[model samples]
Target: MSAKDRIAVFPSRMAQTIMKARLKGAQKGHSLLKKKSDALQMRFRMILKKIVDTKSLMGDVMKEASFSLAEAKFTSGDFNAIVLQNVTKAQIKVKCKKDNVAGVTLPVFESYQDGSDVHELAGLARGGQQLAKLKKSYARAIQLLVDLASLQTSFITLDEVIKITNRRVNALEHVVIPKIENTLMYIISELDEMEREEFFRLKKIQEKKKKIKAAEEQLKQTRRAMGIDVDNDGPNLFAEQHDEDLLF
Candidate 1:
């Protein structure tokens, strides 16, 4: 997935509650992955550039060495015998280790200069000055090859790191983040629906209670009116009893 692409999902109650947490986790993971990926890419480019430069230098050194050797052979009148006897290889020390880059460990190479050894081409009794010149040219070529080899090794390391970084970036951006977001949305939606149902149920109960309270008030008013009527009738009955007693 493109790094710029943002995810889209339905909003929900549980989703809302957990979205912040999930998003934060995803964002943190994504940021780290992006940094790693960028680092790998940068390293790869740098190494590739070095390799190109070293290769070019190597080509030049090879040409110069070949020209020098041809000159020596033409002057000596023995190409094969002279090359086989005179050409000497220099010892190289290559130090290698793993380097940490954006949490990914990769190989790195370093070259060290060792002490030089002198070798005579043949028993031709060559002059000291001529031997020194030939040795210098040969040393240049060997040094160039050493540098090129180091660059090549670094390029290989960068390639492997970049591949691993790309895979992790893809997994987080396309798979892990999406799954967490989906789960969050589901939970939030369910919670919101449950809350709405509970609110409706509470409102119904309140309305029922209000109706009962109004009915109880009406009953109390009716009882009070009946009591007033009874009081008035009691006074009238008392007056009638007084008249009857007087007549007796």
Candidate 2:
């Protein structure tokens, strides 16, 4: 490899060991990410189904409400319009509580219709049956909007959250995890090569030391046989006689 392409500093043995541990941790994290993605996807599908169904029902509810309002309009004064005026801006207090799903909250709303002190003339009709039907239809429409609005909002929120979560999971599964693994493999391979080189170097040094010690012993034996005093660096007649008497 070119100098510029190669790594400037090699990792120590400890670093390679740490990388192996990190690889294992990354694998575990990848599995958890997969589970999270699956769960969010499942939730998305369910919410999508609900939104479709609710919309379909909402259309029918609106149609029935329109027809009912028209009937009431023909029978009596503009009572339908007045009821709408009173109800549209009415209080719709909602209390939110989170469910098991992540990033999702359920909205509980207070009923807007007033029945206790409401004037019967407010939902006036041609007859008692017609008046009752009009009131019932109006209530039905209000309830539908309440139910549909809450569910639709939740569906939209879930869709956004799921999109973000899936992106992260894909990054971990397809990009981040792979990069970490590649780095770990490279570190391990380099560390192995360094270990082998160090082992060979130590072996050569040990052999050289052994050879020098052997040569020194042989020289000492030769000096004694020749009646030379190696340490004193001199030959002596008395030493020669002493060497002859000494055991090998």
Candidate 3:
């Protein structure tokens, strides 16, 4: 195997156990990441759909608001002063909260009117009716704008999170998991080789032992056939057997 494929492990059962544990951990991590990626993808699609719908509504609201402004300008003969007089500290307040989606936190914005109505005396004189219409149109436009902003922010956040999640999933599936499996295979192969080597060494030792035992038994038979007494003690048996064979 190439150096890159080889795992730096001692050829032992302990290393095999460690590698198995690592493989299990890696698989668990891959499963969790895959789930996270799927969730983020689902959220991303929902946010994208919301953005599309909000943009369409925003376009219509903006067009209506623009036409109302034009009508108000024509009827009130340039009511810039009146409009400026009503302008005060912002009454519409936007508050943000965090939403958790698939382990990702996203900011959610909500807008509400915080103070007294500013349009109470907006059309007190001249084109009161037209001024009222303009104010309503602009209010709708502002509401739509806020909605669109929230959707846009969510869309962007989901996009980034989806991208990051996908990268992690791919890395685990392609790189980390494969490397771990390769290392595991390598360890198993080394262990098997070591076992086979040990078995072969044992077989050779057994064969040598059997040959020596057969030779000693044959010598004992020959000593007995030559009318020489044999003993259980190996050294004495060998000496007496040798002396009798030499005399014959």
Candidate 3 lDDT by residue in tens digits, 38-96: 88888888888888888888888889889988988888788788557878788888888
How does each model score on lDDT? 0.67, 0.67, 0.82
Each prediction's TM-score versus the true structure: 0.69, 0.73, 0.88
lDDT order of candidates, best first?
3, 1, 2
Q: After superposition, how far is residue 67 of candidate 3 from its true place, in Å?
A: 0.9
- Residue 165's C-alpha lDDT in candidate 3? 77
Candidate with the larger TM-score of 1 and 3: 3
TM-score of 1: 0.69
Query: 79-192, model 1: which lDDT tens digit per residue?
Result: 466546654663556677777767756656566656654344442553444445555687777767766776676677668777877788888788778766666656566677
Clashing pairs in 1: 12-188, 13-188, 13-189, 14-187, 14-188, 15-188
Q: Report clash pairs, candidate 2.
A: none
Model 1 stretches with alpha carbons more than 4 Å out? 1-19, 76-90, 97-99, 112-116, 120-124, 127-131, 222-248
Q: Between 1 and 3, whose lDDT is larger?
A: 3
lDDT (tens digit, per residue) of candidate 2 on 1-248: 33333233356777667666776787787787667668767877886787688788878887887787677667765664656665644343334455556434534333464335344555433544556676677677777776667666666776777777778778777766676566666777777888999999999989987887688779899988999888876554433133356678
What candidate 3 gets wrong by more than 4 Å, as runs, is 232-248
